[model samples]
Every structure is written in structure tokens, then in C-alpha cells.
Target: MRDMHESSADFSDSCIKEEVLKEKLLRPARDIRSILRWGYPKFSTIRFVADHFQLSLEERHILARVIMPPDRIISRINKKIDCSEIKDRKILIDGYNVLLTVDSLLKKELMWFCDDGYIRDTRYYFSKAKQAEDIEEALDAVLGFLSEASPKSVFFLFDAQISRSGELAGFTRRKLKEYKISGEAKTSKIADFELKTEGGNPESNVIVATSDGIIIDSVKEVLDIPACLMEKMGIEPIRLY
Candidate 1:
């Protein structure tokens, strides 16, 4: 599974500088995609293509994440469920993953509409020092959606190692109750691992809300809350499909 950290690149000036770069690298992106379809090692294949194209580090990072093999792309799309399908189903939230991406979108940061039908932020910009107030609006949008979706139940899990995670969990719990949504928020050292394990459980009628490729691939059903938020905000991500 690819690390969740790798899904990001760097953003600047409140806009993604890579938009123009993406058009220039289209041919290289296609060539890299073709080689990736052959089951070649993703890292090495991308490095070779980047050197051949003389692409910069930022451009290379974008390709490493946004480009997926044909089969994997189809698998991801097939696993995705529409918002209408979210009714009365259990939702396991990847707390920070969803929060950060939506936060990025809210801030007008550079994000991607990847081929796999997921919206992803290119920059990693959160930390233990990140205050709850910083993501207040982002959190509202997320919890607001859940209230509207009317899921059977929701569980929000945060990474305990992150600074103030417990506080964030508490804050989320308050919002959940305020929203009158049936759910709880807690912190775990291995939140990602737990999400993956539970998501893989065939007996659980649960769909995960995350853009993490690893977790998405392991789960049978996925709800793209960020994408839904994008539609609501009338925002379009940088297209890399």
C-alpha cells in the first residue's frame, strides 16, 4: 500500500503551480502510465520517465501520485459509491485525511481530480500545532454532510500521535452530538491500520470516507465526502485524468 503522506505535493500562492506543468507533461504522463500498466515498479518507472522528460521534483511527485495503472484505476472507481447510496449505512471516517483535504479545498489550495475518481490535495500542511479553530469551517462542512446523508452511524478516528488529536476527537464528538448524528470520535495510534482492518471485514456493512488509496482499495465501499464538498462549493480540481 502506498503511504498516505505520498499523496501530497507542494502548493504555493494559494494556487497549484503544476497546472501548466501538467499540460506540458501529458505525453510523459501517458508514457509513464503505459509502462505502469505493464506491472513495472512504480517508483523506478516514474523516476526513469521523469529524467527522460527532465521534469522537476514537484512534477515528479504529482505523477507518482496522480497516475495509477489501468486496473487499479478501474478497481477504485468500481469500489466508489454515490452519495445517494450512503443512506442508512455505517460510515468510518479517516478523521485527518478527510479534514485536511477539505481544509485544503476550503483554502483554495491546489488539489487533483485523479484518474481513480478521488480528489486529492497536493500539499501536506497540517501538524500537532494545528489549532482546532483552524479547521473549524472544514469540520463543519464534513459533519454537515453526514447530518444530511443520514448514515446509520459514523465513527471518526484520529491519529493519537498527532498533537492535540484527542482534543480534535473531543471537538468532533461535540459536533456529532450537536448535529444529532449517532456516532463517536476517538483517537488511535494506529488509526489507519484499524480503518484498513475494519474496512476489509466482509461482514461489516460499512463504507469508508477517505481518499487514502490503501484504505480505499481494501474497502468494498467508499464515500468521497471531499468530492461531494467540491460539487457543493462549485470548485473544480486540477484534472489529471
Candidate 2:
């Protein structure tokens, strides 16, 4: 049954990738023409092209316009747009949920605990090391993806109980700040209560990033905001929206 499930997931992923490839191949000639006419080869041209193609909402929303560094002439001709016009959006992330999904930490620990015999200790240490590596890589991937997406603000909230170590807490705070993200440690003692209290008007514009069924229900009930999970073992969110 597990094998079958894995096979099905692989097939679904392949189908999604194929669809993205097809969309990429169907770029509108008019989009190129418009870019040339305006003499400004901005990434927004991709949005215009996607709209022209009547792409699916999911694809259109996630589509990022890749603006290459223009040649000397185009660079000189095109002026940078003011930042004021850009919509400032915030993302509220369920930190422990994201960490579990990305690193499979709980699953690894469970496997280690369930192991037996003389090799158990060695296996446990090895899994811990691997989990650390996985967490670091996942963090880097997620931060990089979010940075490229260009949201105005991102707030990541983690359960303080689960990440009680000062070193880990400090590391998360510093790393997120380095990426211009506002990271908060929510005490497990009042996790949901804090979220409910903070989930209000201006935060209404915030998108909650989590896949926990209960968390999703609460966010919907409180703010009716949009949400998405951080992709772990598959294509990044930028590719899928």
C-alpha cells in the first residue's frame, strides 16, 4: 500500500511538471512585442503574457516575471518603478508545522526510538545528524523562494516549547531577520490563543502558511485569509503557486 501511494504521488508530480513546461512553451509573441515597444523589459511582461494566454488562476498568481539584467541601452532607458505602488503583504507561518513537514523530524525520531539491538544508538545519532542537515537545507530553500517572491513582509511563528533552546531560537530569529522576515516565538502555552488574538484587520491581509488541518480551520474562521504550505520534497511554491 505504501509503495502504491508513493507511485501515485510520483505520477501526480510528473503531470504537474509537464503542465508547467507546456505553459512555458506557449509564450505569446505579442508579449515580446509589447516589451520591445515599451522599451522596458520588465518582468511584469510575464504577467501580461500569462493573462493574454488565459492561464489558470493558480498558474497566473504564482508566475514570477524574470527580468534579466538589461543591456546598456535598455537599462539606461527604463526607470525603476517606485516601491510605493507595490502591495505589501504579510505571511503568518505555523513554524513547528513547517519544520516537521520539511525535516520529517518527528518521523525520524520515531524510527530511531522504534529501532532495536546494538545498532540503535548509532542509527539514532545518524538520523539526528541527517535531520539537522535536512532542516538547514529546507530553511535555505524556503527563504530563497520567499525572497524571490517579493512579499512585503513575512512573519514566521514557531512554538516556543518545541524550540526552547536559546541557540535554536536565536538562530531562527537571526536567520529570518537576515532574510528580512519577522520571526516570533509563540509559547506553546498560548499558541492558539495568541494567534487568535493577533489574527485581525491588518493581519487579515496576511496569508497563513500551514497545512495543519486544525490551524487551517482556525485561520479561516478568524480571518478568512489565504494559505499555502512550504514545499519540502517537491517543486517549490514558485513553480506551483
Candidate 3:
């Protein structure tokens, strides 16, 4: 067993290493943003910066998710709505996108607020098999927030291509009822497209709950549920910038 002094030393060393690593990433993160703003092809510019910086695969993934051109970032930020704005509003939730980000946060995985002012995770798309309990835990946080926010109604849309997505939708519906929130959950063959379509509708006055860039770009108003959840949990996301 390590003594307290030894443990303190270890922790001090860990913090120092993290600060050093962050310092190393600072320039590359800035340059990537600058080039992206200049209309360079995103993939090639990232690759070029990564090569120049000798960034690992993990670091490259961070740049891909966390950095965006300034205009795009500003546009997304403009769409962002406060939690108070969600009350008595029809919310179209990108179910899996919100869930996975919340799941990553609950598991203490790599999650961060990108330059675009939304929370994102670096996890592979559907890379991990989600157990029922894990899904339940994530939903608890998701629905609990909905309950507190007092939305007029909620609609959760899941990707139909994911295995057992219909089942997940069913589980979500049951949970919604249990939380006494007026909501429905259904799987969609093109959930992202549907989210964009619904959010773009001028008649609906819809408020979308998602961190997806494409959907955010299309939607008039956006909510970052995981970011709200993180605030409630007092967890400051990792800052790549």
C-alpha cells in the first residue's frame, strides 16, 4: 500500500503531466481552427496539423470533434437556447446522440465542450454494447432533466439501424410514463434527417435537444442536454482549446 505522502506525490505528478500535455496541444489546436476557418478541406488540414504536431490517433480524434471553423461555431452558438427556454416547448430529441453523450459522461469517459459550444464525446459510433442497466442510468438522467425542465411534450427519435433500437425506444416510452412526462419514443430509419426536418419546420416552434453538428446547423433552436447534465453534476468537461 502506498503512503499518503507517496500518493500525494503521484497525484501531483499526474496533474503536472496533464498540464504539460495541454500546453503541447495549445498551438496545434489553434492552428487547426485557423486553417479550418480559411476553408481548407477539414480532413486534410487536420491530417497536416496532426503530422506536423506528431499527434497520436487519439489527439487527432479530439481535433476532429472539438474544432470547427469560427463561422460555423458562431452559428451553432447562436442557435443555443437556455434551459428556461425549454419550458412549455415541444422538444425533438436526437435520442441516441443525447444518450451516448450522457452515457459517456456517466462513465467518466472523454467528453468536452468543443469550440462550437456543445458537448461531444470521442467514442466510436455504437462501438460499445450497452447493457440494460447502463441504458437505464443514462435515461434516468435524460428524463429526469426533462421532468425538471417541464417541456410541453417530448419526442425521442432513435436510429433504426442500430441493433435493438426499437426495443430501446420502447424502454424509453415506459420510462417517460414513469417520469410522468408527456412524450413518445420511436425509432427512425433516418433519425438525423427527421430531426433536421422537424426542427426546420417554421410552424412547429420546435426546440431540439442534441449535440449533433448537422442537426444543430439545420435546427433553429438547440439544447445541449448533456452539457446541462454536466453542470448539474458539477463536472467541467475537458477543454481541448
Clash count for each candidate, listed in order shown: 1, 0, 0
Candidate 2 has a TM-score of 0.42
Better model by lDDT: candidate 1 vs candidate 2: 1
The C-alpha local distance difference test score for the whole of candidate 3 amounts to 0.85
Between candidates 1 and 3, which one is better according to lDDT? 3
Candidate 2 residue lDDT tens string, 95-146: 5555544443222211111000000111112322222344665566556656
lDDT of 1 at 24: 70
Each prediction's Cα lDDT score? 0.83, 0.42, 0.85
Best by TM-score: 3
What would the per-residue lDDT of candidate 3 be over residues 36-127, giving only the tens digit for each residue? 87889888999999999999887888788888877788899999998767889999999888898888877666676799899998876455
RMSD of 3: 4.0
Residues 1-241 of candidate 1 have per-residue lDDT tens digits of 1123433453332234555666877888889888988899878998999999899887887887788777789999998989777889999999889998888877666678887998888775355356677898989999898888899999999989999988889998898889999999999999989998888898997899999999998888888999998876677777754
Best by lDDT: 3
Q: Which ten residues in a row have the lowest lDDT in candidate 3?
A: 125-134
Ranking by lDDT: 3, 1, 2
